[model samples]
Target: MSPPTAPSWSLVPDDLLTEFLSLLPVKSLLRFKC
Candidate 1:
């Protein structure tokens, strides 16, 4: 039998996720698809 997979980070709360991402540089943010 296979082991269980880990949960995805995409499940993070919007407000918290945005707040954390905001701390990153603008250039770095642009690198992500958003």
Candidate 2:
């Protein structure tokens, strides 16, 4: 069977977004997102 792909933000757990947010720069984060 094929392996699963990395879960995207919408499909991921809350803590996943939390961890992702911590790694990004403020300016880039703002520009890239809403």
Candidate 3:
């Protein structure tokens, strides 16, 4: 049997995602990068 695939974030638009990320503080962004 094949393994299940991970969910994708393709539903979200790139511009919207970029705006959301920009609103986050540097510390929060750093934490997510790890």
Candidate 4:
């Protein structure tokens, strides 16, 4: 059997995603950047 896959970010609306990302602190964003 195959393992479950992660949900795709493509399913999220671009504007909503941008807004969410903007709300994150710079430290948190830096962690994700790596």
Identify the leading candidate in terms of TM-score: 4
Q: Please give, for residues 1-34, the per-residue lDDT of candidate 4 as tens digits.
A: 6754745776789999998888777769789998
lDDT of each: 0.72, 0.75, 0.76, 0.79
RMSD of each: 7.4, 7.1, 7.0, 7.4
Q: Which stretches of candidate 4 lie over 4 Å from their true place?
A: 1-7, 26-34
For model 4, give the RMSD to the true fold.
7.4
Cα lDDT tens digits, model 3, 1-34, are 6754633655778899898788788769789999
Which candidate number would show the highest lDDT if scored against the true structure? 4
**TM-score of every candidate:** 0.38, 0.39, 0.46, 0.47
lDDT of 1: 0.72
For model 1, the stretches where C-alpha displacement exceeds 4 angstroms are 1-7, 26-34
Which residue pairs in candidate 1 collide? none
**Alpha carbon deviation, residue 32, candidate 3 (Å):** 17
Pairs with backbone N, CA or C atoms under 3 Å apart (clashes), candidate 3: none
Ranking by TM-score: 4, 3, 2, 1
The deviation in Å at residue 33 for candidate 2 is: 23
* Model 3, TM vs. native: 0.46
